[model samples]
Target: MNHNEYMMKKLYEEIIERVGVGIHAVNQEGKTIIYNKKMREMEAMDKEDVLHKDVRDVFRFQENQSSTLLKSLQNGEEIVNVKQTYFNNRGVEITTVNNTFPLTMDGEISAAVEIATDVTRMERLMRQNLRQTKTDFTFNHIIGKSSEIKEVIALAKRATRTNSNVLIIGETGTGKELFAQSIHAESDRSDSPFITQNCAALPDTLIEGILFGTTKGAFTGAIDSPGLFEQAQGGTILLDELNSLNISLQAKLLRVLQERKVRRIGGSKEIPIDVRVIATVNEDPIDAISNNRLRKDLYYRLAVVTLFIPPLRERYEDIPVLIKEFIQKYNELFKLNVKSVSNVVLQFFEAQSWPGNVRELEHVIEASMNLVNYEQVIEFDHLPYQYRKSEVKMAASSPEFTESMEETMGLTDQLALFEKQTIEHYLHKHHSHITNTAIALGISRQSLQYRMKRLDIRVQKI
Candidate 1:
């Protein structure tokens, strides 16, 4: 061959060797002639085995009757840009988008060039993006923004990126489920199901069946069923209050986590499962383990990463924000144009210890919005009588408590009580400086002044 022709052949060979697309040349007899480096790599095959192999023997799929590429090849027509799924030698699934065109020589088909692009990674990413787009997630989906809540969110974000187990601990109404959802939403497996089950909510036998699945007729009325773990395959299953589960159940769960497989109850077959576990508990699992409520080994397995959420009292600054959000939500829900809570009501909200945390605050707002008049500011009267009585009792029970001063009282009695107490406390504490008081309280000076009037807390200096 001439040097120019040799150089041209060398250039084409290099392109086939280095190009990202898997290239294969098949003669008119449908036997592979040229299998490039990429094709070999994608199929996990060596050059020798692929060079003389039949294309059909190396690739299999359900027959497509109207397949353009196959039809074109048979009719000596050119085909291009056809996508198909092909199996490799070891039966691993590979997705390839390709173009197949008949090679023409002397006005006759001599061979065909099949250019296949492996799109498995691209397809997986697209699926992930699509799932994220469809996910219904928002800040309100979580309950609080306290420093503790923020820390939990940060930890959850980090944990989701990895395949580690996570344990979230908090009291009831403290949004343990919210942490679970946030982790799932931030994970690579976010596209998968984020299933949850309260261990305390199920019986031991049923819980076992629900988690590890069951075969048809395993027991009376126990038909074929996939458990929470199976349903959460390629995703996460949040076992809330995992410490509450029985020790026997913990053993099964530990096995699932360690072996990455689960046997259906009353069934001999062990099914493989791939799922991320993010469990939550109100009690410390370590404490549970110490008390024998949870197995020590299982606790260690689940506690690969531990996160804690502080009670609302620790994050009191978030109370006002949470109250505002709750009010707005209930306002729309109850069809009330409730403007805002009076300073008297707000002070009562902030001062009282919330045993139920954000949940208690939400209920208070929801109850007030339903009972308040349209476009009217909610005052102590709009608040539940129990809450108002409790606040009064708490205020009276304090050292500087004033009592029996307003018998047969009206709005003026409440105004006088607030102005004399709440405002007096801040003014005295900050030397009558609104800016200093607001700063100490972590609120805007304007908001502090607003509270002054709403509570009828007068600036004796102003």
Candidate 2:
């Protein structure tokens, strides 16, 4: 070869190696000819492992039916932007978006080239960014006027004044995350990154790496990476359902909290991090402790500024305001002009126990709005099937009854039966909790116990 030809070949090889994407090419005979540097990095393979080998032999194509390069070479076709996920021979999973096409010369198939973009990091970063954006919530966005809710909001607002870790306790669908975000937004570190993770969403090994980071060579295919704690430095990290984390991992988290430092998995150095942590638990902390789902030390560390949000049933006075706000929200979202809910519908909403709390109420309103047919008012029929069934049950259990019941009983007898049914309904709704059932019934615990004894009500624990 001439000197210029040698330099030109060198330049082509350099350009292929320097390109951002991973490039692999196979000759017309389907033998691997080019495996560039980026391709080696993405696949965690060396050039010696792939170069000059048959493409089918290198990838073990007999094991995978979706080899785009082989298909492109065999069919002389092009495939673009196809996402593929596969496990390598080492059992490490790799995900990539690929473009494969036949290299044509003089109207004849000469070779096939495959370009792959590793999207694993990009996808993880995108999810982290999405979690960060959820910190847009603030105190102003919290929708409630009842005294109990106001009290919780007041406590949460006080919590934002300091950098102490916080623990928010509430039942499912009670907007615990909303309170957490509001606290973060109101805090001194409001301008910094706010990251969130659901502890239950991932297995322990993955969740640990995601929370504490991982060092390169921590395990096979583990890259040196910053976890959520590092990503949330100088800001806040909200760990939802913190009790869902295993005890061993909880111990590690507690160490991080106490020391304000995190050590990456399989690394020796401890890195300092300055972040406010806010954790949430759907169940009662006592229950979590008793069930061994949460560590007592971790609980104490996290509950430095504990905030307990009342359930919707306990804050019944907020129902009308919440309904109005939800209606306005759905009106804007659905592009409808629903002005109000019928009085009967409002009564049904107030009387029914909202086990799913505020979230359920929002969903019910959204469903009703969808079924309203441009009507200004949401009627009984517009409610969800569950709510409709509730309305029927309420009507059937009311003091006024059907002709069949009247034919069998007198007024006094009917009144006694209705009273018994009401007590039983409240008991079942409150999960047979005597105190809560009494509170809902507008009676003292002693009075409720007396009624239960007199009425032969057998309270069974749920």
Measured by lDDT, the strongest candidate is 2
* Per-residue accuracy of model 2 over 1-462 as CA lDDT, tens digit each: 999999999999999999988999999888889999998888888888888887656563324456788789889999876666665556566677778999889999989999987756534653664467447688898888877889999999999899999999998999999999999898889888888889988778678888998776665445567888888889999999998999999999999999999999999999999999999999999999999999999999999999998878777668888999999998888899999988767756655567798999999999999898878998888998987886557557685678788788754455456657888999999999999988998754655675566568899878
Displacement of residue 101 (Cα, Å) in model 1 is 66
TM-score for each predicted model, relative to the true structure: 0.58, 0.68
Go through the candidates in order and give each one's C-alpha lDDT: 0.72, 0.83
274, model 1: CA deviation in Å? 0.8
Off by over 4 Å in 1: 1-140, 143-145, 395-462
Candidate 1 lDDT over 1-462, as tens digits, reads: 999999999998898899877887888777788898887887788887667777667666655523334455668766554556656667776766566788788988888777776655434433443343223553347656556567776776777678899888887777777777777787787777767777887678667877787775565334456777777788877788887899888888899899999899879988899888888878776688788888888778888998887666556667777877787788778777776787667666755557787787888888877677655688887787799787667556645444554455544455456545755787888889988877776555655665566556766674
